[model samples]
Target: MWSTCSLARPPKQHPYENRGCLLNDDVSNLGKVLEATKQTLFSLDTGYVSLNRILCLFEVWKTFEAKSPSGLCVLMLDVAELFNTFDISLANATQPADMERIPREIEENIGSVQLNLRLKDALVTSADHKASNRHGPGKDT
Candidate 1:
């Protein structure tokens, strides 16, 4: 019997630590698959226009506000893990032959991914430099 496990914890700090762990497997491949999917879906100009429309709708809804009900309205939804309910036929249909090709394509098409990483690294380095500068030559507390 097939089983699916939802990751309860976020990705680890170290990339090397991802190996040998099932939770990290899918996420590791996500970069590649994401790029491939983007390329496949957007090759046609219509797909790009469709994506823009979807984004526009999402942005509008994100800022929408509704009036409060009476004193206050509270809503709750159950958060539970359900395992092994996936349909294998559907899964087999979508599985990629070569996952590594995805990230390569993504790098080629979307320059933002690399730029974003660089920006994040720069920010982290800048923060560290600022922290050291603030300490400023002896005054141990």
Candidate 2:
């Protein structure tokens, strides 16, 4: 057999205020509230989409390669910190702006971007080393 016990003292505040509380209620009736919340969420999402579209259009106009395949290629490469390794002196010389706030206009036209040649060479050397190592030291077997 089992016995049920009642609380010895009542809580000062509502049960909802007591850290975590369990209440049994019909949440199905909150459809309108849920729908409104969803709409608000969707509106924010759509706003982001619109802003992205606007930025894309602006980039197209700025690059003037919008109609060219090269334009699309350049746009795709516009990643975060893409020019992180860019020479600041060269950038300043070409753009001729304040150290702070070098215009996007100048950034778009920096001549002769540097490739990661050192990384390419390193990869080639590593591959060669692996290939040579696989042959082993003076073994005919």
- lDDT against the true structure, each candidate: 0.26, 0.26
Measured by TM-score, how close is model 2 to the native structure? 0.19
Clashing pairs in 2: none
Candidate 2 C-alpha lDDT tens digits along 40-88: 1111121222112222222222222212212221212122232244222
Instruction: Give the top-scoring candidate (TM-score).
Output: 1
Minimal lDDT window, size 10, model 2: 1-10
List, residue by residue over 35-109, the lDDT tens digit for candidate 1: 332111111122222112222111111111111111111111211111122111111101132223333333464
My TM-score estimates for the predictions, one after another, are 0.22, 0.19
- Residue pair clashes in candidate 1: 32-103
Which residues of candidate 2, in runs, are more than 4 Å off?
A: 1-115, 138-141
Question: How does residue 50 of candidate 2 score in lDDT?
Answer: 18
